[model samples]
Target chain A: MTLPIETPAVLVDLDIARRNVLAFQAYADRHGIRVRPHIKTHKLPQMAELQLDAGAIGITCQKVTEAEAMVDGGARIKDVLITYNLLGEQKLARLARLNERVTVSVVADNATVVDGLAAFFADAGKPLTVLVECNTGADRCGVGIPSEAARLARRIAEAPGLRFGGLMTYPPADGAARVQAFMSDAKRLIEAEGLEVPCITSGGTPGMMQAAEAPIASEHRPGTYIYNDRSLVARGVASWEDCALTVLATVVSVPSENRAIIDAGSKVLTSDLLGLTGYGHVLGRDDIRIDQLSEEHGRLVSDGQIGLQVGELVRIVPNHACVVTNMVDAVHVIEGGAPKGTWPVVARGRVL
Target chain B: MTLPIETPAVLVDLDIARRNVLAFQAYADRHGIRVRPHIKTHKLPQMAELQLDAGAIGITCQKVTEAEAMVDGGARIKDVLITYNLLGEQKLARLARLNERVTVSVVADNATVVDGLAAFFADAGKPLTVLVECNTGADRCGVGIPSEAARLARRIAEAPGLRFGGLMTYPPADGAARVQAFMSDAKRLIEAEGLEVPCITSGGTPGMMQAAEAPIASEHRPGTYIYNDRSLVARGVASWEDCALTVLATVVSVPSENRAIIDAGSKVLTSDLLGLTGYGHVLGRDDIRIDQLSEEHGRLVSDGQIGLQVGELVRIVPNHACVVTNMVDAVHVIEGGAPKGTWPVVARGRVL
Candidate 1:
């Protein structure tokens, strides 16, 4: 049988995506925390608009170019929070232009990044909002201690053409308690120095459901909920039904009785295992494990008869959704199991 | 203290790339083997032209759309080989269209893919070349044994509008003996069936230096030879000086004395570890290790003082060059440490 679309295509179930967006928005609403969804997951302007319409406070981006693409794609995005340390003239100048287009805020863990931001936006009519990124145990980026968080907050507040917005942390899995403890102490310390912490944001798809446990956080940013993947499912943060983005691939070769090769490989599904074993989870085929991947082929193997044929189509929930979305230029949109059309991943490859 | 290009940029050193291309071409020339360089590494038309100018027979692509991009990018590419088991009507239709531009050939391990190619090109003026993909050692794709390879070759030879070209295999590392053994058996079997084995191709960057060992192979396809990466260096196939592609990223945050975060992450460097330990090798900083990566940040850590200051530019040779080439939209070209212009990754995101 002919497939609905081409093989090895990223298929975003719009109905499921909308449901996921609204479900997370309602969860945050119930917790009395704002939802500032990260656009790195979908990267499509229409998906960002859907989140905004579903009661998101604004949108969160990782780079200036991502924010530029989102706003340039004609999304009604008026506010953007770039949750990365802005450095260099090229990035800062682009951030300044994006600031002119929308109310933009950024995060910084050191005085160097804060100084660059201040120097670039020194003469702007509106000061750029800056957040102190605190390390609540992720050990990725951010201040290691609450005292350092307060110190950076003080630096951002003292810098010209910058307003200290609050604190932000990309917390570890189940790290709501750590985020609360770290940000609470930092907030108390910054308040003692006569500065107000306007907003405290904590983000992670793994700890998204526990966002309310951190009562000090004014907002939470979760990027993977709209298109949950096998990683989230493995963490019990999302179920298979919640997965909206899947790679629809064709079996190009059944090399063995136990092995069938699909067209989606590292180029499409990506090599982001996210701590999972296999490349992806084939829907309705738990017996089949996507064992390996080359640039353009995914190897599916089973213990018994594989029961797959060449030209057979399979929808796979990749191990990580965000990276897969970034790998594709566009996604074929599906609603209620029927192909609707396609949505250009407007913010894809905007890594500048 | 300004970087020549933006942070998190893929920089291709033209001097090193040209040297690598010519070095490989010279190696293949001594072996009297044709060089069909895979375009997946640099994905640049100019790089393809350089390869062809270095006496390469043609270029190899993993996808039909990638072939389309390379040919459309104004490269003087007259011949192409897509080393993939392409199935379905859409891909075959596009492959048919690509055939109109250049002499295109494909590989298949099953009758399904062969029938699709035959049905697509049955009414075409020129017949399409089909090679039977044999699984010598790497069990990714292809027929498992020589008998299966000969059977598929006979099928392709008898198929209308298709010409049985030869045998092709993506061999395992250090599998030159295996390639010769399998291809020699398959050639004898196919010849007994009154079919001529015009070409027997084997490919792997790890085995590129040993291409001459497999005397039965007529040509070798190596993608990562042009832009050697950390994996190639680890395999002892290429040295650090031979690496052409490096990610020029800035240290955006110094979270601690032992830790620094770069702007390049999995989105820029990719998550294809290729069985290596760290994400990449940071040049000029042997003491530092890139221990972790998020979508937009790479965590560099050292046992002692990292010494990497914020805003410092560092060049990293990623674990895999081919996947890193697909992450960015364009790469900045550098010659002898000076910045040239940029080249769009013409075949990037063309998974279809």
Candidate 2:
């Protein structure tokens, strides 16, 4: 099926996306660390398969709905780990159901959450894995100290139908050393009590670049490597050519000589500014800035040097690719400027 | 279905939502104006039905997929108007098909777009209503002056299988008076040439509060009023109580005495910012500031007076309601602190 070169459509360069997957897997291989790419970035089973085929140990997801979507879309059992605190009856029920299908492990900082997971799994007659998430530095979700991490892990092991799955942490951006130290200390404290340490998962895209140097972590979970974006480019992790996703938009209205409006806007590109001024980077013109984006139009402010006419087509690399993927119904796959096919963002709004 | 008091789930106060619909419809009724509530706000057929039942002339959508979703979900025929420029073969084919089910009209600012629609309808053996969109000052999509507007309208009228509907303009935030003048001039110019003007549509929630005073427009398309947001409140168009939608989030991490983190971050709340200093307004706590938002965590800086512990629930009024609605899978209908039901944001990611 041929797609119109319209604004706001997520365009995936399959070649670049595959290369991104391979690069990360190779990095993990070189360091003897297991790779667990987070599926939250693409939210597609095919991408997950690519990672798994490239030697990923498993995948991590932020929401149960995302995990469910992935498993239902053909992800293997005993490979998906959810990195969110499980709360409430509805989510716990879903979590219990998910445990029946896979080796589902969840993170928790407080004993209350561990008890809740224990009650859920015990009632469901299933054994659930619990990871004591330590706040190495991010301070988002995790226990503060090694003693607290040990206490949470001990509570999980003591709770019925729960098994201690070792330590997990989403460290700060510059936290490779911190994660290494915390993991080493927490493991020693837990092992000193003669308990088993089955896993040590610590990863995020920003921290993953330095994670290979951290000897304590057995596995890494990097989500954004599958589709590098402008944020990654800014951080020197990836380049423009490495960005696998771009929004295909049409120049709808050229109101003035300097300003032209594209059909793609905040709804498709997303307002995930990611600290970058302007919405996204124009594909070919470094001089042109997507100055503003309304609901359905992206205003492009161009330097006078590059002359752009009305009704012309332009590709924009969004600041954040994962959020952009969530904002669209379907993404068009293209190879060398020719449309290949369109894939529906099946789990586009699975925000439970 | 019992839902936990999470901090970041989109909450639609059914009473206030219905009231906003009724109030907007009442204003249209008193002025002898047609009110077409934009479905891009809530993206639910049920909400659109409530507006129609309360005397809405029709509904306005931003994309072909949105219109398709609404019509498939039981929106009335001969009433839905798509206020976007239709381009490309795939979208034009959908537009031609949509004309069979509804009174579908599109706005175009350029002759190329007008010609594209005309060719598609001509090939389909149908006549489509085309509105010449005038850029009264939004600088988004539309012709700049009345002469360009008349030129586009004349081209549409002269083209085969296309009928010139009327003039449409999405005015700037403070350009209600400018829209009145521009539309009046365009209408007079077209009438002087013995042309028929069927409709004059002016839109924008900020300008819609004063739309009745603008005599040139026969209809108004205000999107955000169905769920007033912090931007509307900041603009003095609506009050805090008048806001029908909010994000119910959970305080998952109280890292420090002055810092708290919630589960709803940029991914759920969106990063529209819209020139606001913070992400959203924490209801009943003007002292707390949403300092930053990562993809899945909202960091709140408290002013020490308000003591908030972990696992506490809070309601956040989003900076922009429409963008936030597009981020979620479903919205909870809350009445007096209890969830009446959950409505799937069926058209949440319909950005074709």
Q: State candidate 2's DockQ.
A: 0.51
**Candidate 1 residues B160-250, lDDT tens each?**
8999999899999889999999999999999998889999999988989899999999999988999999999998889899999999899
Each prediction's RMSD over C-alphas, in Å, is: 1.3, 2.6
Cα displacement (Å) at residue B169, model 2: 1.0
Model 2, position A56, has a per-residue lDDT of 92
Q: TM-score for each prediction?
A: 0.98, 0.94
In candidate 2, how many Å is residue B325 off? 2.2
Instruction: Report model 1's TM-score to 2 decimal places.
Output: 0.98
Q: What's chain A's TM-score in each predicted model?
A: 0.98, 0.96
Q: Evaluated with DockQ, which candidate comes out highest? A: 1
lDDT by residue (tens digit), candidate 1, A253-320: 88889999999999998888878999999999999999889889899999999999998889899999
